[model samples]
Structure formats: C-alpha cells, structure tokens
Target: MELTLDDLGVTLSRRRVLDGISVILRPGRVTAILGPNGAGKSTLLRTAAALIAPATGTVRLGDRNVATLDPRERARRIGYLPQNAGVHWNIATSEVVALGRLPHRAPFAAPGQHDLDAVTRAMAATETAHLADRPVNELSGGERARVLLARVLAGEPDWLLADEPLAGLDPRHQFDILDRLQEVARQGRGVAIVLHDLLHAGRVADDVLLLKEGRVLTSGEAAAVMTPDNLRAAFGVEVSVQRNTGGGLVCTPIGRALATA
Candidate 1:
C-alpha cells in the first residue's frame, strides 16, 4: 500500500497547523518526519491516519481517497500510535494488545485463533511477551511505550504511522523498536514515523522529510535531504556531515559559529 498527500493543509479554529504539505510514502521503506517542536509533525501523522480531517487537500491511500473509506475499514488499513497515549483501564498488557484486533472483529464476536496468534506474535516481537499478564498502569514509561507499540503492530495494518514512539525508551529499547520497524518495512509495509532524534532518523530512515512552520523544508532520500546546508537552514546550527567508518552519514552539530566573512 502507498499513501500520497496532495497539497494537504490543516487548520484548527483560526490557526493553520499544516500548509500545502505534499509527500508520498511507499511500501518497503521507512520515512521519517523530522522537525523542531510544535512543527506540525504530529498533525501530519494524525491527518494521514484519518484521525483528523484536513481543512484542504486530499489524502489518497493507493487509488481511493482516505476520506471515502469507512472508519472501520480505514482502521484496518492504517495503524496509528499517538504521541502521548494513555491507558485508563487496569487491563493486562495482553488484553490491551488484543484491542488492535477490534477493527477486524465482527460486532459482539470474540477473537478467534488467528487474532490470538497475532497478539502473541506482536508481544514476542516487542519483547513484551513476558510482561503480558502485567497491569498496564503498573509498567514503567518505557515498558508502556513498547506495549503500546506492540498493540499497534498487532493490527497488521498496511500503513503504520507512529508519533515519537521512542520518546520514553532507553537507548537499547530505542534500537529495538527501530529494528522492528525496519523489519516491518522489509516485509513491504509503508511506515512513517515522527522522529525527534536526527541521528536515529539517519540510521533507519530510507527517506527523510523535514518540516518547519507547517511547511516542508526539504524531503527526499536521507542522504540528499540531510545535507549540512539544509540542517543549518532548518536548525540554525553549524553541523558537520560525514560518512561513518561503518557506513552511513553522521551529522555532528559542532555548535553555533559566526558566519565567515
């Protein structure tokens, strides 16, 4: 599956949050959205996930406009993880992960064997299988994040949109989540993630989209979009972009320096 946003603009009340943003997400690749705080990255993800209606423009999933799809159908096609998701119930982690299957279930029907298989697989993949019986509210912040991620993955949606999925995770878990996303992409699913860590974005994203003030600053392959000039322009910091000895680019912000005469 693929997602294309055509001149998508979103406005709330009287404030414009996203403006003329156009981008394409293709399967078998990871696309990272990077920007400063309050740059509408979350807004874009929400629009793509059909959680919010765009004030203007269209979001096409494959050939059909997403707005035309029924809410249940859309939920089955796109899995979304919000920035700050809270679990209000004292449910077990396994039960919470099982909620992802709701989109596929018939009304008042119980989950079948296949749904149980998916839930188990998702927990195993996220390393949360051992914590399955634990109460969601009792988990640490990072543990809760992974369990939520497992819930999203259990949906088995064609498109996955995640907002700051790594926010509360430690370095090891951060890599684990990114690696899982990469595995998903390799299985030919479209994955778009809102990433705060530029270094992690460079490490995992096949394509990079940089946003500023609700506008696209630059977007393309990671190598092309992550140039020092663009980084300086978007972040206002001097950075050194170099290829790591192990391969791939490393961007080190050397700190603010006066422009040379």
Candidate 2:
C-alpha cells in the first residue's frame, strides 16, 4: 500500500500553499521533504495525513481516497506528528503516549492489553521508557520531542508523516531519531518527514523531494535529487558535494549565488 498525492493543489486563507504536488509515499522506505522556510513542507505532511483537504486532485491511501475513509480507519492507518507537537496537560509521559490509543479504544473502555503493549514498545523505541512516569512538562525540549514522537509511534500506524522531527535535538539524538525512523521504514511502513538538514536527508532518505516556494524543484533518489546544481537552483547557494568517511554524501554551501530569490 502507498500514500499517493495526485497533483495536489492546496490553498490556505485564499493563498495557495502547495500547487501541483504529486508524490507517492511507498512502504518500506523514508521520503524526506526538504525545503527552505515557508516552502509548505509542513503543509504537504498535513495533506498526506488527511488533516487538510486539497483544493484540487486527491490523496489516496492505496486504491481508496483518503477522504472516503472512516476517521478512525484513517487514524489507525496514518500517524501524523507535527513539528513542536505539544502537551497541554501536566500528565505522565506514558499517559501522553496512551492517548494515541484513543482511536483503538471503544467508547468509555479502558486501554486493553494491545494498547498497553503498543505504548510500551513505542516508549522503548523512542528511548523514552525511563521517562514513563515523569510529567511531560518536566522534560527538556528534546526529551519532550521524543515523547511526542513515541505518542505517534504508539498508534503503530502503517504510515508516518512527521514534520521537522529532528528539530530541537542534539547531534547524537538527531542521529538516534533518524536511525529509529529508518528502522521504522525498514519494518515495511512508509515514512514521510519534513527536514532541513540536507546531510541527514542524504544519509537517511531513500528518496527525496525538494520543494521551493511550495513547488517541487527536484525529486528522485536522494543522491540524484540533491545535486549541486539543484541546490543552487533551489537555495541560490553554490555548494560542494563530497563523500564523507562513511562514504555518505555531504553537502557544503561555500558561497551565495547572485540568483534572484
């Protein structure tokens, strides 16, 4: 199964945020959406998660349109974790994650064995098990981010759509989160994440879609789409693409180009 966006055109407050956006998020791999600020990266993730309706075209989950699916069915199949997802309550971390089970629970029913197991596994995957009992507000920003991610993971959805999940994280935690996300994709689920770090995108994503001004500049295999020419075209920066010690590609922006913004 796949989450496919077919020629999507979305408008917010009478202004088009995404236009002619067409991409397929296939199972078993990560697709990173890279773009500058206000390029509609988060908007695209919202569309994929069925949180926003497109003005044109359609979002399909497999052969069925997402708009036609039941709300709980959509929730059970697609997990969306927006950037800086917040917890308003002073509740325990595990409790925060348990909230993800709402879609699975019957009306007025307590969490079942499956729900509990999923929460536990999610906490463990995000390395937040130790913070199980801590109040969500007590954790640092990075730690809170992890807990929120676990909340999404607790749903065990077939597709993950995360917006800037690597933000507010240290370098090690960034790697840790990326590795975990890659592991999620390897488990035969699809992952679509918004990212600003081109290096991390190159290292972790099997495919990449680069957006500029809400339109796709280039899209394909990460290595192919992130060429120096594409970088200059998208970001107006002249960059040097090189191989690191691990043989992964690294991009370095050496100078700004005189291209019009």
Candidate 3:
C-alpha cells in the first residue's frame, strides 16, 4: 500500500509548523526527508503517520483515510519510530521489542506464537538478539535505538516512518540501518526516514523530499532532487556534488550561502 498525503497542513499552538505538504511514498522504495534543522521534517512525517492531526488536507493509506480508521487498525498499518528512542523503565530488551505486537493481541490475552516469532525475527534483524535479557535502560544510545527499531519492525506494518533514526549511531551502525531499510523496501514495504546525512540519503533513498522553513523546496528521484543548488537553497550552504568509485553521489558542503536578516 502506498502512502498518499495531500495538501497537509498542521498548526501547533497557533504556530504553523507544516504547510502545503504533499508527497507519495511507494512500496518497494525508500523515501528520505532532508532539510535544515526546524525545517518541519519531523512534523511532516508524524502528520503522514496520523500521529498529529492536520489542520487541513488528508493522509490516505491506499484508498482509506487513516484518520477515519480505528486506532488499532492504524497502528497495524503504520509503524512510527519517534526521534527519541528513550525507554524510561528498566524493561527487558525483548519485552520492549515485543510491545509492537500489542495491537494484534486480544484484550488481556497472552501473546501467541505469531507474536513471539515476529519479535524474534525483528530482534535478529536488528542484531539485538544477544541483548534480549538485558534491560533496555542500561543499553547504549545506539543499542537502545536498534531495540526501538526492532520494536517497530516486529509489527510488520505496511509503512515504516522513522524520525532522525540515524542520530547517535556509529558509522558502522548507520550503514547497517540504511542497508536494512533498503532490504525492507525490497520486501515490498514502504519506508520513509527523516535524515540529515545527505550521503546516506544519496546512498539509500530511492526518492527524496527536500524541505526548507516548513515548505517543500522540491521532491523527486533522490539524485535529481539533491542537486548542489537545491541543497544550497534548502540548507543555506554551498556544496559540491561529486561521484565516487561506485558512481554514488557524494555531497561536500563548501561554505554557507550569504544572507542577511
């Protein structure tokens, strides 16, 4: 199922955080949202996932408006990983990951084999299987992030929406997560991530949405939309676009673009 967002606008405490945001996220592809800090990337992703109510427009999951669907049903179709992956309690890692299955369980019922299997698969995919017995609160930032990602994956949702998922991760872990998300898309699940790493977006995202000051600068194929001029326009930084040995696009910021308030 594709995620179709149309003319989405959101206001928080009388501040317009998102305006005229619209994009299509397709299955079998990874769409990365890129922007400067406070560019409303997180707000757009949350609104698309129905975590935030839009002041105007709509978010449709296939042909169904997500806002009109039951909460549990929406949870089953969309898995959202917020910017902060902190778990306040001293909960076991496995138990924390298992939380993804809650939407599928009957009221007060014990988890069935399906739930256990999904949790196991998710933990393994995230390389968190070894930490199953450890308390989540004791893990490092990257470890906890992986565990939280596992929690979202355990649900086997049709769409995965993650905010700043690469933050705090080491280079190796960052590569792992990006590669894993690509594999997820290959499995025909739609994946969208809020990313600041332009190189990673070039490396993994099939599509791109570039935003600036709560407005979309452009959106399209990753390579085409991430031009030096567009990057400079959105980020206020001059950059050089180069090609690596693998023919992958590499973005090197040269300097800040001149502007006066």
The prediction achieving the highest TM-score against the true structure is 1
* Candidate 2 clashing pairs, residues 3+ apart or interchain: none
Q: Could you tell me how far off, in angstroms, the CA of residue 174 lies in candidate 1 after the best superposition?
A: 0.3
Candidate 1 lDDT (Cα, 0 to 1): 0.91
Ranking by TM-score: 1, 3, 2
TM-score of each: 0.96, 0.95, 0.95
2 versus 3: better lDDT goes to: 3
Candidate 3: C-alpha RMSD after superposition: 1.7
Candidate 2 lDDT tens digits, 1-261 = 888989999999999999998887788989999888888999998988888999998999999999889999899999999987889999999999999889888978999999999999999988999999999999999999999999999998899899999999999989999998999999999999998877788778888899999898888787888889898888878878887787667877788987565
Assess candidate 2 and give its lDDT.
0.90
> Candidate 3, which segments miss by more than 4 Å at Cα?
245-247, 258-261
Judge candidate 3 at residue 21 and give its lDDT: 84
* Residues forming the 10-long window of minimal summed lDDT in candidate 2: 243-252
Residue pairs clashing, model 3: none
